[model samples]
Target chain A: MKAVGEESASQELQRVVGAGRRADWVMASIGLAILIVAMGTLISVFADLIHSGWPRLTDPDFYTNFPSRRASDAGILSAWVGTSLVMLVTIVIVIPLGVAGGVYLEEYAPHNWISDFIEVNVSNLAGVPSIIYGLLALGLFVYTFGMGQTVLVAGLVLALLTLPVIIVATREAIRSIPQELREAAFALGADKWQTVRLYILPAARPGILTGAIVGLARAIGETAPVITIGALTFIAFLPPAPLQSDFPYLNFEWLNAPFTVMPIQMFNWVSRPQAEFQVNAAAAGVVLMIMTLAMNGLAIYVRFRLRGRVQ
Target chain B: MTSVDAVTEDPLLVRGRIQPSAEFLTHRRLADRLARVLLAAAAAVSVLVTTGIVYVLISESAGFFAHVPLKEFLTDTEWTPVFENARYGMLPLLAGTVTIAGIALLIAVPAGLALAVYLSEYAHVTVRETIKPLLELIEGVPTVVYGYFALLFVTPLLQRIIPGLPGFNMLSPGVVMGIAILPYTASLSEDAMRAVPKALREGGYALGFSRFRVATRVVIPAALSGISAAFVLGMSRAVGETMVVAIAAGQNANFTFNPLEGAATITAYIVQISMGDLPYGSIAYQSVFAVGLVLFIMTFLFNVAGFYLRRRFREVY
Candidate 1:
């Protein structure tokens, strides 16, 4: 009877071991499958982009001048400049507002329903689809504010779209700072404002900058919202300076000028019937991809550097 | 005699009674007041941006309702704003949006969950570090790149596999969108899974459970709320995707159930209309807002649902 009981116990152990091995195999297989799918998509995208864009890459004119009516003369210079100006303006507009809002929420604001409600809505706004921002821009900037399709209006709309992301990221960065640092400053007789300005701001700067850059990158890729604001599809001219062109110097006209962006230009190119234009679109994709990737890389580097320094 | 001498010496101290200067006090008060005012102004900006969005959407949508009846706009089958005679049907666009979102979720949820599981449960530290950055690389690729890929590669591949596939159809674009949002779902789900306490896993392991069993039965169940939130958010992103659908999925706003056929999403429709010259204040112009209102409502609902689910079912442990 003792021998039989021991035999049964060992058999049960074997059964459990068998089940465990089977589960491991299953999970490993699933993981392999997912990795394959993801890598396959990435590889194919690069392959296609190279295949389409390789032929036209040697064209010196591709990077030199603005697109013209003739297909052969078309380049992305104007669109690139326009995208840069709009992005720069968007960064300038969103960073201060977003950082301040984040500072208020994380460092100063009393914990209450009002702050909580704002936090909730801000998170919601982050998820509120980029196209909806376009609609908002159309109504507010174009019709109500009567700013028309100028670069300033486009920049403001993109700024609004990115505000929530910047705010959220900045809040996280600020919250991650050890409370002891703030307390230590306070113990040294530093006021709340002084502590935030001197110590907290410096400590949080890397993270805050990462968030702002990422938000700017997102705005750079955005096409739907800017398009809806009526950024000109075929602007051959450079965008006028915001202060000198639009406000008092230019009589505050809303419908004075038109604008275009890289994504919109690519869209226009892709929609055309010509195969060469499709190739140009792919090349533009490569450029836009590089720009966004550079920003993301910088952000990741900053985050890591900051984490190391803090440690 | 000593006490009398000390009292006489205190006369100098009595003559030296001093206070903080009035300018110093006023400057301090002014600084405090300025800080308060600045904070108030910042708070007001947040409120204004938020309220401004709702007001704009509502007002434009109200203009739309003035021209078209609510029932017809909601239930109509066709969406051709550029037609010689336009119909303001929003159903087709909504259906297209839902169809693509459904396909995208089908692709994203399972693969993303698997990636999350691998990273959280099975991957070595080095592997996790490498894979995490790779996943972020995927996330960082611009939507336009994905659009171009969908248009130039995926659609052609689909055409080869499935004969007579439209150059611009829902399936290719939807699949591309899934790839685009997969990192978001995976990263968030991985964070959620990691949040599940190590003690629970140890307890399961002590009971002789396998890592797979522990992960699936213990960790995943523990992080179900966050995983669900990630899934919902991914769906919202898929629905909101514009460039992919715009480039690969044609701007034919017909209410078709077939994935192989061209369909127009609400976003694609807005892009299509806005890119061209639709006369201002015409019915075609109002249709953009009408469609925008619908898109806004759908995304808002998803966002709210995702928020509540993440909050309500979030486990402290």
Candidate 2:
């Protein structure tokens, strides 16, 4: 009778375990399906954009002409130029400031209320909607600084949106460097500056680059802040070329010139009731996505390499 | 270590300063002090950004409040700022925001958590490595691209199944926003789950639990604080998401929760007024700031709460 009871208990355990395995199979597949759905959406978007946007690409002028009322005449000249210029401006501002801020928090700042204040407020700033950044630029840059709605203002706004991302990323990278590396440098009588300059920055390079690339991608794709700063929705004209016809060939006037970006241009096109404009928007999207994917690929590669080494 | 110590103990070097010249040392000290000040200034920029955002939103919105009673902005149901008789009701936009954002969270939280479970618990290392970057690549995709996908692909597909679904319904954008935010949810949750020590899973297994039970009942509970952090961050993202909702969820400020209808969120409303030819200092222009202030506060609270949860419940190994 005791042996029979033991056998029945064994059977019960088998039954429960089998049920769990079945549940696991179901749950795991469900998880995979979710991933596939994500990939499916991405693949479908790529295919759809290419299918619709490919025809426009054959016309080299598609990359050269300014926005026109007629879809047949429209190209992305002003839009692309504005985007590149704004990115350049953003890069100049964000990298040094973001890296410095990150370094201070990670390596130098004390673990006190002031450091805590900066960290918490930075996260909060990161969470503020892109549009609110636009509002700040509007009030601060456009009105107070008297910059008007120019490329510089838009660039500044995007930089603010990306600063928190870079700071957090930099800190994470700096944190991952084993403490022993720093201790060794200190033991050799290296000052804090020498230790950071000689070892810390070099070690954190890959992580910092990954962060900058990701942040740059974000700044490129932003729309709301640029819009809030009152970037022209319709710009048939390009900003004056830095290489100008005048004696001072490097023009500074374009810094304050009104601008439009790729996403904003796409937005304006999509808003038009014309069926043709929809195709143009699709084409513009393909271009925008290509830029984003390129940046993302570089960042992913950097992170992948870093993980292999750092971990 | 001995070679370095022997060099340090050399009679001339041991007595001398670390650097060659006193002038150089003074210069170096000045540079170090300068560097610290610069770093501090750089760090302060973030604080300034927050203060600037708050100040700008409040100052502009205060003008809006002075024009329209605060009670009316809160209680009224209409949001027809551009109509012949402009009514400044905040609810319609909010209703639309809540509906799309709610739908987005509903879809994202479950799928993202399950995906996190798979990556952390079940998948092989190779599989995890291959899929992880691809998943995060979705996060890097521009919101505007998601917007177009929703409007162009998902909306048409949904309309085919739901016969009377509006062209610009909340459903399509809602789902697409979930897809857009999937990385944030899944990545955070995966990190949290992976943080649960191996011994805990072994403990569950030693008790005769299967991998599934070990993950769901034992592991997830251990990482609840982190998972909650993910949930809050996801909510914040859903609320602030602008492009997809603006493009696919219609420009009309509909005061309904039905997923089949077109509606405008606060972000969408900002897009609408900005696109129009609103003269500077116009009431409509200021109203967008008012709307933005609302969006700002909502996201701010969620983010701080999420941050606190992460700090509070983070399990140390």
Candidate 3:
């Protein structure tokens, strides 16, 4: 009877172990299925965009001509140009401001309540909806400051939007540099600015670049804030030339000119009832997606290759 | 010993050699101080942004409320601000936002958590590294593109299966938005789960626990705080999302809980008004700010809650 009981107990143990192994296999498969489903969605979206937009995407005229009532004649010249100018302004404003802010927070600020408060504010700002930034722009830039619905206002809005991203990235990059580097610089009698400028900035440059690209990629696609500030949907004329024939070769007139970005142009097309407009929207989306994905891919590559060198 | 004693005896020479000139030192010190001040001011821009957001929302909302009572704005079900018989109630938009976000969470929570678990536990390092960036690429795709996908692709597909589904129903956008937000939740939760020490997993296995059992019972519980933070942040993201809903969900402010019907969200409403030419300071214009204030408050509360959860339940280990 004792032998029989022991044999049954052994069998019971084997059965439980078998069940656990089966369960593990089931969960693993389920996880893979979820992953496949997610990837499948991404692939299908790309394929669909390509399928719909191939003709227009191939057309050279699609890149050069102004938007027209005729779907076949319509193009994204003004939209792409506006997006480029806005991005240029945004990059100019954000790099210095975001880098300085990040450097201060990570390297200079004392570990006190004021610093903590500023840190908190940065994180909170990151979570604020992109549209609310639009509202803020509509009120503050467009109304109170009276910047109007120009390229500058669009630039400023996107700059503010991109600020938190770059700052966070800058801080992370700075933080990842080993403490010994800072100590060594200090030991050599380098002051704070000298240490940061000489030792830290070069090491952290790749990471900062990655952050800037990511931030600008995000900013380029933003439509709500630009829309809220009253970007024209039907502007056939381009902003004035940046280079003048007169004494001041560089013109500021483009900054004050109204604009339309790629996404907004896409939005305009998508909203139209015509089937051909949908094709245009898809074509524009494909272009925008390429730009965004390329930037993100580059950023990832930079981080992957450079992250090890710092540590 | 004789050389050291001679050097120590020449106090004036030692002082002159050790210390730089006051003029040079003063210039360097002033430059450093100025840089510090400038950088500090740069950091303060974030604070200024927050102040600007708050002040703008409040001041504009105050103007809106002066004309329309607060009671109607909250309690009323209608939200036709541009109509001749303009009703300022925002409940329908709120309902639409909640319903879509709820559907989004339902899809994202399970899928995202599963992805997190798989990445943290099952994926090889190479696989994780390769897949993560691609997954983030899903997020890096503009929301506007997602909106187009919802309206052009998902809606058409859904119509064949769900009879009587409107062209601009909430279900498609909500689902796509879930997909859009999935990468965020998955990556963040994976980060949390990966932070859980390996010793804990080994201990579980030593106790005769299966891999699945260890992951579900031991690892998840240990990483609960971080996973919860990810969920809250994802939730906030879903609520704040504008483009997806505005494009796919119809602009009609219908007060319905069902996902089959079309409805306008708070974000969609803002976009609709902003697209048209509404002069500044008009009640119609101020109304957008009023809705924006509501949006700001909702997202603000969620962010604060997320922050609190991260801090409050943070484990030292």
Candidate 4:
């Protein structure tokens, strides 16, 4: 677009040489510094947390006992237990619905407004502030459904919160499969359902697993909706084991049991005035951080592996 | 059809036939139809969630306006919804939210852009691969944990360096919020910058521009709309950030521009109110919905703008 003659090129070379070289180099150095400092904060945050929490974390009682007025006596047994239970329920609820929704949108839904509506709304739901989900749960689950503030209700809310992500991710995974596989299946007299089940899904399994794991990771860390569901800050008792004395042994009374999760426990500690509780909060945070980052790392690894295989 | 049927009758050609037994085919068809209906119903759940959110927010907030005048809620300087002489002014909370977001953007934008530039242009594939997932490790860390980090570690650090920094100030949370959002901004903007054709870089190099100059002036300008969208989206994340501000940025609702002061956000206010057992449909209870309504409208607008900008720029490429 600019003057491109040989004379102009020489002139431009001189112009760039005089001032632009130093400025650009300075900008690049700044860019490097920015990355360093950005990552440095993460390191320092974790370092400080580990430093403060390390001594207390080694104590067995930290995970064996429950919340206590004395921070030294407080632990996270119920919190961790409840978190796993909630995550389990959420996974059970979300995977089927999310995968089905993804399958439908990718394979079955036609070029129409219902498809468009579902697609657009799902993406938008991905952007909604999770606290709004808390409000929705407060109104819908805790009151409207009369589920009370229980493990099942909390799990359902978190499931709702992550449904969009799973759906969107699953759709992306499904979309990555080649069209020819479906066509070949169809040519062999496979119906839409059979083609999807026999050909596309198996090929898409790695991608779908990647999405589901990532989505579950998010559900595990979510706090706002769980808080809104009124998980107790001082949960001294564990929910009943998901079984009974009878031969069938399956019991859902635990579903209605009050619960607390790691994040909530950490929140309670951080909010306290006591200095010891701050350390306690730090310890819990370090544990929670490890859990979340490990989940994320595994998800990323799975995704990377999938991409390698796909190509 | 006749040819296919004739082929199916031949023992040697049976395996190649498209159709199986008629009875089995009908049964499979029925199952397929039923399964399609169920899968389609699953797809409809996302729409149901959207409707449920809209219905709850609207229906609850509808009764809030009957008591608090809309003009006062918007314009009044104070927000003391729980105090005896209560003022339901949204400005104080809005100011806190905007101020934190503003401070957060000041930190995140330049850092994010720089990180994007470094990642997109400077780093090799292996280096980028390793570093990127680590950054996302930051992204995936729970906000509550970040809140704790800001409150205990950062606030103390700030106090040591900057004399008289408040115990519960906005600066730490805002800064942490920036750090929290770095991955989103960096990743999105890098995607944009990378999408700028390599020809642009070559053009700059052909014109005697250095790598840095080519990256900054050439690729960045080309991706400006997408970069701006990332910044806007990051700002939206800051505004909606809950536990960090609630934990680190003090819960006192104040009308102030100073970053050193304590203040509450719309989210914090909701959290604070929820700490109590407010009876359903009470005026105070209704106020949470009203605050959420404002928050929803604010974020919704920003998200729409970001989405539109990303789309518009995407089309150009």
Candidate 5:
């Protein structure tokens, strides 16, 4: 009777194991299907954009001409130029501010309420909708500071939107450095500034770059805040040239010039009732998508290299 | 000889005083102090941003409230601020926002959790590495493109399945938004699950548990706090999303929970009012700020809650 009970127990264990293996297989299959669906959506979105936008995408003039009444005549010259200038201004503002903010939080901040308040503030700002930032710019920059709806205002808004990203990235990168490196520098009679400038910043370069690029990539595609700031949807004129042919070769007039960006251009086209305009929207999208994806791809590559080195 | 020894042993003797000039030391110290102040100022900018957002929203909304009573703003169902006979009710927009966000969360939470589990527990390192970046690429796609896709692609497909479905409906945008936020939720959840110690999984295995059981029963429970954080953050993102809902969902402010219907969210309303030719400081213009205040409060609460969850249940292994 005792031997019979042992045999039944063994049979039960085998049955359970068999069922568990089948369950694992089922879960794996479901997970694979989910991943494939996600990737398939991405590819299809790209293919659809390319297919619809092929005419404008292939045309050389499509990149050069200003917006026109005729769909075929319309190009993204003013839009692209405006986007580049705004991005240039954004880069100038965001890099130093984001990197410094990140360094202070990670290295200099004492364990106190002030640092905690800043930490909470940064995360909260990250969650605020892009449109709210536009409202802020409308009230603060346009009205109070009298920056108007210019390239500088757009840069300022995007810089603020992207700041938290860089700060978080910098902190994470800094955190990953071994504590022993800082200790060793201290032991060698090096001050905090020397250690940070020489050792910490160099080691964290890849991660910080990745963050900055990612932030810029996000900013480039943003639409709502720019719209809120009242960016003109139809801009036939470009901002004044930053470089001039006369004395005082640099011109500051463009900073105050009104501008439009790629995504806003796309928004204007997509909203048009005409089918031809929709085609133009698709083409514009293809251009915008390429830029953001390339930036993101570069960031990922940098991060991968950083991970490899650390490991 | 004794006098010379006494001079050499003086604590304040000129030991290396010539090697490093006092002036140079002061300069270096000044530079260091300057760097710290600049860095702190940079950090302070974030606080200022939050302050600016609050100040703008409240100040403008106060202008709105002085004209439209708070009760009417809350209880009234119609939202026709742009009309000649303007109505200040915000419930319809709020309902639409909640409906779309609810739909989005329903789809994103499950799929995201499953993706996280697969990445953290089942996939090989090479597979995970390749797939993770590709998944993140979904996020890199702009909301405007997703909006385009919702209007042009997904809506058409859905219309064929359900005849008489409106061209602009909440269902299509909500679905696309789910896909858009999936990477964010999945990546965060994966990090949380990965943080669960290996020893726990080993213990489950030693108890005759299979990998599936070990992951679901052991790892997931251990990482529950982190997974909740991901869920809340994703929810916050879904609520704040603007362009997709604005383009795909109709511009009409519909007050209903049915995903099949078209509606405008608070964000879509802001886009609508601001895009139109509203005079500065007009009632309609100030209404955007009022609506923005609502959006801000919703997202703020969710973010603070997520932050609290992350800190409160942070498992120190």
Candidate 6:
């Protein structure tokens, strides 16, 4: 009886020890799998982009000329210019509105039902898919406002789509400002508006800027919304200046200026049956990725610098 | 001192500080009231945007329902939106969306959960931090990149092993979508696992329960609500994903379950219709909105459910 009891106890110990080893192995294996897959993906994207972009990088006119019908003659200069112009306009529209609204909600507005409703809706808006914004641009910007499918209308639509994200980030940043700072500003006889402008805005500038850049990156990649708003497929000319140009001014005859963006261009290229187009798509993908990465890196750097200074 | 006197004499300041006349007080109250009004107007933008989206979808879809019976739209098998004699059966598009989403979940959940468990319970701090950012890089990669990668890399690789795999099939896109969303699930699940109190793990350890057993049986179940939320959010992402399905999954609007064959999701069909030169006020054009409405409804339901789950079962500890 004593021997049997000892034997069972030792067996239980063995089982427990084995289970522990198995668990550690399983965890290690899983961690390895995730790291491997992520690394593999990053390397592959970089590799493919470089391989495809090498040829395009050699062409002297690649950065200066417009896309042409011939495969050997096509370039991305106009698309690049259009992308920059629209993105700049979108940032100009979204930053002030998003920041001011965030400040109002975080600093001035009372914690009441009205504010709560706005808050919930804002969060929900953040989750609304991008394509729906395109639909809104179609109905309101294009149809009701009659913007005539210009870059202005497209930029406005993207600004709306990115507003919620900017607002959410700005609100969080503003909320993180120390209450003591606000109290000090008020004690100095500054009114609410003065306090926000002088103390709060300067203090929260880093977070606000980071959020704006992130929002800009998101807007830049958006194709579906712009497509819905009737962004043209093949514009030969540069976008007209927003104020100086009359309604459909660059030839109202060409009011339906076929426009294309980096993402849209890449999408079109990728879907074509020819292998050359796929390679072109990969090259465009590289450009888009570089642009996105640059934006994200700048935002990250700014955030770190701001945090350091504050500390 | 002179500057201070000049500032005090400014009209806005004079209006702010004077507390004498009844008329002045009334005007001051009006100014305060106007500030509140301005704030309300600012807050109205988001609400108006949402309302506009819904109204547009509804108005366009109303025209669609008028022309095609709701029953036929819901039950029809063919989806030839381009042909003059097009059938507007939405079932096939919906089925394709669900199948792709389901397969993506199948791929993402296990890997994500396992990764979460490892990061939460096993990995060293250095490894955890390094791996976490790397995983998030997957999120940072634009969906368009994923779409091309799927078409260029994953499809070719799969064809090597899976005989009869179409160049554009559900498998590659679904798998790529799963990978794209893997970070979301893993990061969230890791948070949930970490939220399981140390005391629970200690108790299991005292009782001779192995670490793996404790993690699988105690920590995961304890964090099930959050884990489930992660899964739901992943599904929502999969359903909403457009570029991958548009590029990789062939635009054949057939109702089938095979991952190896070509398929068309609702978003893919929407992309196709939007890309072409379909005339305004045409049924083909209306169908895009109709499809958009369905997509909207599906994602909205998921979002609401996810919000509720996160609220109800969120662990304060």
Off by over 4 Å in 5: A1-7, A308-311, B1-19, B313-315
Which model is ahead, 1 or 2, in terms of lDDT?
2
Regions of model 6 farther than 4 Å from truth:
A1-4, A8-18, A108-113, A186-191, A241-258, A308-311, B1-40, B125-127, B194-211, B313-315
Interface RMSD of each: 7.5, 2.9, 5.2, 4.3, 6.2, 3.7
Summarize candidate 3's per-residue lDDT along A1-311 as a digit string, tens digits. Answer: 67667688878788879989998888889888988988899988888998999999999999998999999999999999999999989999999999999999999999999998898788878889999999999999999998889999999999999999999999988988889988977775667876787778888999899989888988988988898888888879899988898887899999999989999999999989899999999999999999898999899988888777767
Residues B1-317, candidate 6: write the lDDT tens digits: 12224324535544455343566446545765665566556667878888888998998888888888889899998899788788989988988899898888897888899889888988888888667756755777778788999988899999999988889899999988887888888898898888888998998888877778888888988888888878887787788788888899988898888888888998888888878888777888888889888888887777666666665455456
Question: In angstroms, how far off is A104's CA in candidate 2?
Answer: 0.6
Compared with the true structure, all predictions reach lDDT values of 0.81, 0.87, 0.89, 0.84, 0.89, 0.78
DockQ leader? 2
The residue ranges of model 3 lying beyond 4 angstroms of the native Cα positions read A1-9, B1-24, B312-315
Report the error of model 3 at residue A117, Å: 1.5
How far residue A38's Cα lies from its native spot in candidate 6, in Å, is 2.1
User: What are the candidates' C-alpha RMSDs?
Assistant: 7.0, 3.3, 4.9, 4.3, 5.3, 4.7
lDDT (10s digit) by residue, model 5, range A146-245: 8889999999999999999999999988998889877866765456776677667877788899889988999999999999999999999999999999
lDDT ranking from best candidate downward: 5, 3, 2, 4, 1, 6
Docking class of 2: medium
Candidate 4 lDDT over A59-108, as tens digits, reads 98998998888989999998999998898899899999998999999999
Q: Supply the DockQ value of model 4.
A: 0.48
Candidate 5 residue lDDT tens string, B1-317: 12224323435344655444566557657878988899999999999999999999999889999999999999999999988899999999999999999988888899999989889989999999999889878998989999999999999999999999998899999999998999989998898888888999999999999889998999999988888988998988999999999999989988888899999999999998878888998999999999999999999998888877676556466
- In the order shown, the candidates' DockQ scores are 0.41, 0.58, 0.52, 0.48, 0.52, 0.42
Count of clashing pairs, candidate 1: 1
Error of 4 at B232 (Å): 2.3
In model 2, state the lDDT of residue A192: 79
Report the C-alpha lDDT of model 6 over A137-192, residue by residue, as the tens digit: 77677776777687677778889988987887889788788898788766755556
- Runs in model 1 with CA error above 4 Å? A1-7, A240-257, B1-29, B313-315
Writing each residue's lDDT as its tens digit, candidate 1 over B161-271 gives 999997889999889888889889999899889888899999989999998999989999999988998998888788888988988889989798688888999999999
Model 3 chain A lDDT-worst window of ten? A186-195
